[model samples]
Target: MKIEQIYTGCLAQGAYYIVSENEAAIIDPLREVKPYLDRLEKDNVTLKYIFETHFHADFVSGHLDLSKKTNAPIVYGPTAQPEFEAIIAEDNQIFEIGNIKIKVLHTPGHTMESTTYLLIDENGVETAIFTGDTLFLGDVGRPDLAQKAGSVTQEDLAGILYESLHNKIMPLDDSITVYPAHGAGSACGKNMQKETVDILGNQKRTNYALNQPDKESFIREVLDGLTAPPKYFGMNVAMNKGGYDSLDTVMDRGLNPISVEDFESFAEETGALILDTRGPADFHKGFIPNAINIGLKGDFAPWVGNLIVDVKHPLLLVADEGTEEEVITRLSRVGFDNVLGYLKGGFEAWKNSTKEIDEIKRISPAEFAEAFNENSKVIDVRKIGEYSAEHIDNAYSRPLDTISDWVSTIDDSEHFFLHCAGGYRSMIAASILNSHGIRNFTEVEGGFNGIKKTEKFPVSDFVCQSKTL
Candidate 1:
């Protein structure tokens, strides 16, 4: 038997592939299904099952497409009322693939349909458990995300999660390997560890949520300090729960190369958002005026989902020449399927055509230090937690994720300097400010990290007491 964890770093998500003899099963697949199809071909195995832990909110799952292509039955746990056809297995029901057996454990806390699949080897030894969002390495899934209107509250879900963990999961063998859906960078769980896989015994000892003395403590800890989920989460969940257009169709529509004249006309005609997916440094040099920069080098998809908020919004791309397909694929992962096309020759073509181009003013950390003054305005675009830990003495704590709430209140006449941990997020802020016609700010070249290295500015350890705008 072979077990493989296909981990995608940008999303911090893991999908599993298990093969025993000539039969295989896939768990929690990404939207693009080519990789899984290729693997099945290489191994010469027939796909027998597509198992989904729950209807995911972060990215669209490829269960429907994979099932259609492989003729495999899509499996879900009880109480999962998906719009598509699937086998909703009962709790503790076992399914076989070749020589191995998979036993379903209905662990519904992350979502009503959340489940963990126990892998029993040919010898009937319980081996591994694919605990979707129900459990992570350092923390369990946040209980607040699944709350419905006037129905199951977060506390109710938390109680259910506690029961699931203690009654179903904790009773398992200590040696069983635990593989989760997400890692540290994901918003699904606040305090997930960097490691993607761990033994159940180690997690029981180290994971805070697993060690909570009682249900009340578990609920309070899980719900505490959870920032609001991205606005696009519900949209992605809708697409995953219902169905979406084929990835093939989305690619065919997005991969079209449009001329500079047509691109400009299309933007005017369709009112599509121009998304520049180049690196922050390159994008700072020059870009199409009003284009938002969420660099492909960083956490591109999540930032797009957070900032853009709507998956159906039409978008026109300005990507590095050879990376258009990649940008489109990433966008599609988050259910952004309305991508019209890309700039034919990238930003260079727009620059060469004498189109109105805009560039952001960027100052190095050294320069920022030299120009420091009591009257200078600085904006820290990092998260509130990071800003509270340490930041420039008098900088305003305006997190990039919550920019939409406070950006309109900024006084355009007053000049400001912006920075994030590195330059990635600040550049994103700069572009958004530019789009809003508030371009009087200078972005720090290397953000707070660089500012610290200069050793000139006074860094404050005290939490910022600035009033929310």
Candidate 2:
């Protein structure tokens, strides 16, 4: 038997492919299904099952499309109320695929229908357990995401998670491999380990959630310090649950290249957001006026999901050449399917057309420190956790995640200097500030990372933060 974890670093999500005796099964697939189709064709295996741990809130799953194309049955654990036809397997039920068996263990903690699949080999020995969001490498899933479903409270879900872990998951043998849905950089869990895979035994010993001696302690720890999930999470979950347009359809509509005239006209007609997915340096140099910069270099999809709250928000892209398709695909991954099209010839086309262009002022960190010494207002757009850890002595904590709530607090008259840990988020903050007509600001080029490296800057020691959303 061959088992592979197809990990997508962009989403910090893992989808599994298991094959044996010319039969294959896919677990928790991304929206784009071509890769999985290619794999099946290459292996000459018939896809037998598409297993979903739950209706995910992170990204749209490819189950419906895969099932439609391959005639594979979509399977879920008990209590799943999908809009379409699916096999809701009972707890502890086993399904056969070629020479191996996959046993469904209904471990509903992260959500009401969350499940883990135990992969039993041809020898009839449990080899590995695919723990969706129920368990991570170092932390378990947060219990708050699905709290509104069935009018259940987060504490109630935490209690259920505790029972699910102790009763179903903890009983498994230590040697079985544990494959989770998401790793670090994901909002699903706090303080997730960077490692993607771990032995169940090692996890039991190392994972704080698993090592908790009592259910109350486990729930408290699991639910502690969870920042609000992104606004787009619920919409993504709904799309995953009710089904969404196929990736092919979404791309067919989104990948069209429009001329500068048509791009601007479309934006005016539809009120489409102009999203510039270029490098931070390129974006800072010049961009279409009023465009928001969420660079494609780092955490692009999740950041888009966070800032662009509307799942159906129409977007016009200003991506570098040869990256339009990638930009569209990543947008679709996060449930942003209403992409109108991309600017033909990228931002250059608009520039050559003599269209009005805007540029953000970027100052070197050394320059920032020099100006900061003179009493320029500074805004640190890092998360509360990062702000609390250590920051410039006088920097105000205005985290980018919840920027809309407190962004108006920036005085219209003051020329503020903005920075995040690195320059990426600060540029994002800059764009948002620009959009709101608050452009009297200078973005620190290297942000706090470069600021702290210079001896002229005053870096503060770690201090406990009291800010909360």
Candidate 3:
């Protein structure tokens, strides 16, 4: 028997491939299914089932497409009322894949249909548990995301999660390996460990949620630091529940190369968003006026999901030549399937054609330190937690994620300097601000990290009492 954890770093997600004899199963697949198909072909195994822990909210799952291609049944736990055809397995139901057996443990807390699949080896020894969102290495899944209108509250879900862990998970063998869906960078769980796989015994000892003395404490602790989830979460969930466009079709539409003239005309006609997927440094040099920069090198998909919010928004890409397919694939992973096309010949074509170009004013950290004053307007675009921990003495705490809410509050007459931890997020913020016609700010070259290295400005470690300037 072979078990492979296919980990995608960008999403911080893990999809499992388990093979025993000539049969295999896939658990929690990403939107792109070709890789899995190729793996099955190379291994010469027949895909017996496509297993989903729950209807995911972060990225659209490839269960529908994978099932369609392989004729494999998509399996979920009880109470999962998906619009598409699936097998709603009962609690403790046993499924055989050649020499091994999979036992379904209905652990519903992250969502009503959340489940953990227990793999029993050919020798009948309970080996590993794929705990989808229900349990992470260092933390449990946040209970607030699954709340419905006037129905199950977050507290109630937390209590259910506590029961699920103690009843179905904690009672299992300490030596059993635990494989979760997400890791530290994911928005699914706040306190997930960086390690993707851990022994159940280690989690019981170190995971805060698993050690809670009572249900009340577990609920309060789990719900404590959770901010609002990304706005595109619900849209992805809807697509995962219902069906979505085939990834093949999405790629065909997005890979088209549009001429500069046609690109501008399409933007005007459809109001499509121009997304520039280049590094922050290169993007700062020059870009098409009003294009938003969310670099493909960083946490591109999550940032796009958070800032853009609308998964169906038509997008015209301005990617580094040869990376258009990658950008489109990443966009489609998060359910952004309405890509119009990419800028033909990359951004150079637009510049060569004498199209109006815009540039962001960036100053070195030394320059910023030389110009620092108590009265100078500054914006810290890091997370509130990071800003509160340590920031410039008088900088306003306007996080990049919440820019759409506080952007209008920026005074046009006053100039501001913007910075993030290492400049990537601030550049993104700068581009969005420019797109909105609020371009009175100059970005710090290396953001707060560079500012700290200068040792010229006063850094405040005081906990922020207020968010205002």
Candidate 2: worst-modelled 10 consecutive residues by lDDT = 460-469
lDDT of 1 at 71: 96
- CA lDDT, every prediction? 0.94, 0.91, 0.93
Once fitted onto the true fold, the runs of candidate 1 whose alpha carbons sit more than 4 angstroms away are: none
| Superposed model 2: Cα runs more than 4 Å off | 462-469
Better of 1 and 2 by TM-score: 1
* lDDT of candidate 3 over 386-439, digit per residue (tens): 988899887788889999988878776788899999999999999999988988
TM-score (C-alpha) between model 1 and the true structure: 0.99
Tens digit per residue, CA lDDT, model 1, 223-265: 8898999999999999999999999999999999999988989
Write candidate 2's Cα lDDT for 14-85 as tens digits. Answer: 999999999999999998899999999999999999999999998888899999999999999999999999
Clashing pairs in 1: none
TM-score of 2: 0.97
Residue runs of model 3 more than 4 Å from their true location after superposition: 462-469
Q: By descending lDDT, how would the candidates be arranged?
A: 1, 3, 2
- Cα RMSD to the true fold for all candidates: 0.9, 1.7, 1.1
